[model samples]
Target: MSTPDRLIEATRELLWERGYVGTSPKAIQQHAGAGQGSMYHHFAGKPDLALAAIRRTAEEMRETAGRVLDAPGSAYERISGYLLRERDVLRGCPVGRLTMDPEVVASDALRAPVAETITWLRERLATIVREGLDRGEFTPGIAPDDIAASIVATVQGGYVLARAAGSADAFDAGVRGLLTLLAPPAGTARHTDAVVSHHPAS
Candidate 1:
């Protein structure tokens, strides 16, 4: 990679591993194998480089999510695909993690990408829920935007729950619970029976 690319990638990794306060410019330079002069030459400073890295992460998150959301499937299938997709649960979310950082949340420039990414996800999911309601797949009482927000909340909160417990079971349980709620009444009965049968009364 070029000097700029290297710097941005390194910053991305550092940001993921360490929050904005924890990731230093020196650490970014070392991680990138670029000297101080090269880093400064390519960018104004740490903020500039970090912004680039954050934007890249945000864009990638949107693209990956779109793949699942846009795929050929019913609303439930598409949402489930997204919720159950491969993720480094123990590592938490790359873009969502930034929302926890005080520095990132405090700065408009830094926060914009993260905020936009989440808003986009909520909007996309809401659209799918709306479609399902129109098709009589989802109950009429359920609000698209509300359920969309809850879905995002469930995933993000699942990560927090799993990380706090030091196990992915918490995350899996949360997803399963959300799936149950999302499933139709008949579908929920089958899902419940399946789960009950699999565990076999402990």
Candidate 2:
């Protein structure tokens, strides 16, 4: 990788593993195998480089989510795909984890990408939920925005639960429970057998 790319990538990894306060310029330089002069030449300072790294991570999250959400499937199936998609559960979410860092939260410039990414995810989920309602895949009287917020909460909270227990069981269980709730009642126009069958064992 080029010097700039190396620096940003190193910052991204360190930020995820160590948080904003724990990662330092010297550490980033060493991790990237770039000297101090090179780092300074490529970026303004630590905060600037960290911003670039965070933005890149946020963009990646959006693209990954978009692929699943936009894939060809029933609304419920698309949502199920999102919830069941592979993730590094025990390590927690890269963008979501930043909300816990004091420095990251305190700085508006640093926090913008994290907040934007979350808002985007919630909005995207809400749109899918609306589609499901229109298609009769989900029961009526359910609020799309509310369901969207809950989905986001469940995933982020699941990560916390998994990390705390050092097991993915908690995360898996939460997802299963949510899917069960989301499944349409039996005898509906569309059967839920497919959805139930697709769920990963908890």
Candidate 3:
């Protein structure tokens, strides 16, 4: 990668692994194999580089999520794909993890990407949920926005639960539980079967 790209990529990894407070310019330089002169030549400082990195991370998150959410499937299936999508569970959600960092939360520049990514995900998911509701794939009583929020919570909270336990089982269980709740009444054997089949063993 070029100097600027290397710096941003390194910063992204550090921010995800170490958080804003834990990451340092020196550490970023070391990780990127770039010197202070090169870093400064490419970007202003830590916060500047961090914003670039966070924005990149947020963009990648949206793209990755959109693949599953926009794929051809029932709303439950599309959501199931998102929840069950491969992830470094122990490492946690890159953007969501930033919300826990006091420094990131304190600065609007640092927090904007994180907040925007989340809001975007919820809205995208809500759109899918509404589509499902219209097709009678889901119950009419449930609100799309509410279900979307719950799905986001489950994924983010699943990361926390998995990290705390030092295993991905909790994450798997959370997804399974949500899928169970989301499945339409058992009368539609195909729909129920598809949902059950997608869940990993708990």
Candidate 4:
């Protein structure tokens, strides 16, 4: 890769692992095998480099979710696919992880992409729910915003649960529980015994 590309790749890895505050220009230079002078030649400084990395991460994440949410299927299929997409549940959201960082949250250079990525995701998920309601996939009373919020919450909380328990099983349980809620309402065959059992705990 070119010098700048190498630096951005290095920054991406560092940000995912160490977060914005923990990451340093010297560390990035070392990881990229570029000198301080070389890095500066490519970026004004650390913020410039970090903004590039953060935006790249956001765009990549959005692209991946767009694939799942925009796939060929009914809205239900696409939304569920987007929710259950493979992830390092313990590592949590690359962008959402910023909310926990004082430095990242305080910097518009870092925060804008993160905020936009999440906003886009929730809106996309909510739009799918709206479409599903239009197609009668859900009960009439089911609110699109509520369900969308739940879906986003489940994914976010699932990561926390997995991280707290130090097990993917915890994340699996969370997803199963959320998917159960997204199931069709009661007194119906769609309410499997297992799902019924999960409802009380959820």
Q: Which model scores highest in lDDT?
A: 2
> lDDT by residue for model 4 over 1-202, one digit each (tens)?
9999999999988998898878899999999999999999989999999999999999999999999999997676676677667787778788778778888899987899999998888888889999978877777888788888888878788777878888767767777777666775554335334433432222
Q: lDDT of each structure?
A: 0.87, 0.91, 0.88, 0.81
Listed per model in order, the count of residue pairs whose N, CA or C atoms clash below 3 Å is: 0, 0, 0, 0
Please give the distance, in angstroms, between residue 56's alpha carbon in candidate 2 and its true position after superposition. 0.3
Q: Which segments of model 1 are wrong by more than 4 Å?
A: 185-202
Candidate 3: worst 10 consecutive residues by lDDT?
Answer: 187-196
Instruction: Estimate, for each residue in 34-148, the C-alpha lDDT of model 2 and write its tens digit.
Output: 9999999989999999999999999999999999999998888888889988888888999999999999999999999999999999999999999989988898999999999
**By TM-score, how accurate is candidate 4?**
0.89
- Residue 128's lDDT within candidate 3 is 94
- TM-score sort, best first: 3, 2, 1, 4
Query: What are the per-residue Cα lDDT tens digits for candidate 1 across 1-202?
Result: 8999999999999999999988899999999999999999989999999999999999999999999999997787788778877788988999999999999999999999999999999999999999988876776789999999999999899889989998878888888888778885454223433442342110
Per-model root-mean-square deviation over C-alphas: 3.8, 2.0, 1.9, 4.2
Question: Where is model 2 more than 4 Å wrong at Cα?
Answer: 188-202
lDDT of 1 at 92: 92
